[model samples]
Target: AWCCGAGGGVKSAFPDLALWTAGQRVDEALSTGATVLSSACPFCKRNLSDGAGNRNVRVTDIVELVAQAMSGRRMGLT
Candidate 1:
């Protein structure tokens, strides 16, 4: 989640709220013309990806992108 409003014990304690919060972030990301959502935190990635659902968005970790970049592979929605 780019804006950082999801994850931590919130998702563990209140899952519905976590996904709902993640949805808000995904909406903002969509507005910015972002095709891929990236986060280093597993919780954020999981929650945000769940929020993305059928939308044309992909959730990834920054490390993955860096690795792709190092390998000279373009990283983005395919």
Candidate 2:
């Protein structure tokens, strides 16, 4: 339940800080051994995906998850 760190103009005004914050949140998610991190916000998905660069985590939107589920596609680490 942590922020993806793309809020309050922090991403545009301070890219590095935003990335760092997003990375922290990603790390927290990784700690739980989660392979996918779903967000309701597009900005969060972008920031979190950027933060997850080179990692085994997949950052995606809830809508996409639903679409995949509805389509009967398996969602996993790729």
Give the candidate number with the greatest TM-score: 2
Worst 10 residues of 2 by lDDT: 1-10
lDDT of 2 by residue, 1-78 (tens): 777789988899999999999999999999989899999998999999999999999999999899999999989986
**Which lDDT tens digits does candidate 1 get at residues 1-78?**
154446458887887888888888888999999898888887788888888878888899979878888999987788
Give residue 51's error in model 2 in angstroms.
0.6
Predictions in order: lDDT: 0.81, 0.92
Model 2: CA > 4 A from native: none
lDDT of 1: 0.81
TM-score of each: 0.86, 0.93
Taking all chains together, the TM-score of candidate 2 against the true structure is 0.93
Best by lDDT: 2
C-alpha displacement of 26 in model 1, angstroms? 0.7
The reply for model 1, stretches above 4 Å from the true place, is 1-5
